[model samples]
Target: MSVLIENMTIKRGMKKIIDNLDLSIMDGEVVALVAPNGTGKTTLLNGIAQLLPSTYKKLEINGFEPQLLNFKRSFFYLESSSNLFEYLNIKEHLLLIKKNWQSEIVLDEVFRLLKIYEYQTLPIRKMSLGMKQHALLATYLISDAPVLLFDEPLNGLDPGSIEITNGIIQNLADKNKSILFSSHDIANIQAICNRVVFLKDGKIERDTKNMDEILELYKQLYGG
Candidate 1:
């Protein structure tokens, strides 16, 4: 397993968002955290990223704990485009990640892959929402981490960009990247994810490979 968390619980003040969750993700597998807002989707991602205080009887990334440098270097999680530096441009941001992660993926290749070549010089503050979203993905590609955590990877994207994002994610999975992403776009998730897991009572209520099941559950939960 690329990700393993057992008996995990996350609390915000007095409230437990995720309680005693036991989830494991395998390499080359794409899992969807399918749930409505405030259901610990982001909270789970945050806990895995160590951005929040989560207690786990066992929390590990390929045997390395989150506090370990090796574990930290193995995953890329960009919560949102808002985390982009307003002053830094795409090239600068990607360069920073590449250096930190020591990735071999060339900068120019990433530019062409994401078609972000022109945006390289433009500061993030000047970019549109869609452009910034691409910039965020650029960082993930540059990091070349084994585990990719995406929070709404398709947000603020045009149809064309959305297609590109989906293709890129699929290609990454083909290369054996363990991916976990959260999105309410049921149709989109049905397109790319290998499995869908939903939360109920702070635990995974369902982990199904059936896309039809996901659609049916989506309607029941979200009234689509």
Candidate 2:
């Protein structure tokens, strides 16, 4: 699956959140959207995913409009705090995810990989932030969606968790999944993404290879 955006813009009354942005991701690539807060990274993703209205734009996933794609079956969006059912135990969550995604064979494997097997019977509401994030990622893995979008996936994770997340994303990319994710973790971005799209004030500030060098140049450009 692939995604393409051309002249995409979003507005709220007088405010322009996304300004004439054009981006494209080929099949099976991991691309990172990097920016400071309030830069419309999430809004851009929302538009691409058809979670928000675009004023004037052309957005397509696999040659079809995002709104027309069978999102429930082919796409997964993982946000920072949307990990659980809030009322269900871990086992119930895993079981529901397995049933929803038809991934019974890998449910236990994902759980063990995430090291959440011991907490499988506990309520998700009682888990820590990192724990919940792990559970959420595990659910995504179980879903086996061809397109995965992540927002701030590295937040609140320890060093080991960060490494694990990076590895999981790399594995997904190797499996030919088209991935678009937003993050401020430059190290992780450099590790996983082949190219970078730098956003500022709702527009693309830079799109370049040599991500590490670009980050340093941008820092110098901003006198940081």
- Who wins the TM-score comparison? 1
Q: Against the true structure, what is every candidate's RMSD?
A: 1.2, 2.2
Q: Pick the candidate with the highest lDDT.
A: 1
Q: Can you give the lDDT of residue 89 in candidate 2?
A: 70
Q: What TM-score does each of the candidates earn?
A: 0.96, 0.88
Name the regions of candidate 2 deviating beyond 4 angstroms. 98-105, 220-223
Off by over 4 Å in 1: 221-224
Candidate 2, after superposition: displacement of residue 82 in Å?
3.8
Which residue pairs clash within candidate 2? Answer: none
Q: Rate the local accuracy (lDDT) of all candidates.
A: 0.89, 0.76
Quality of model 2 by C-alpha lDDT: 0.76
What does candidate 1 score on TM?
0.96
In angstroms, give how far residue 93 of model 2 lies from its true place: 3.3
- Model 1 lDDT, full chain set: 0.89
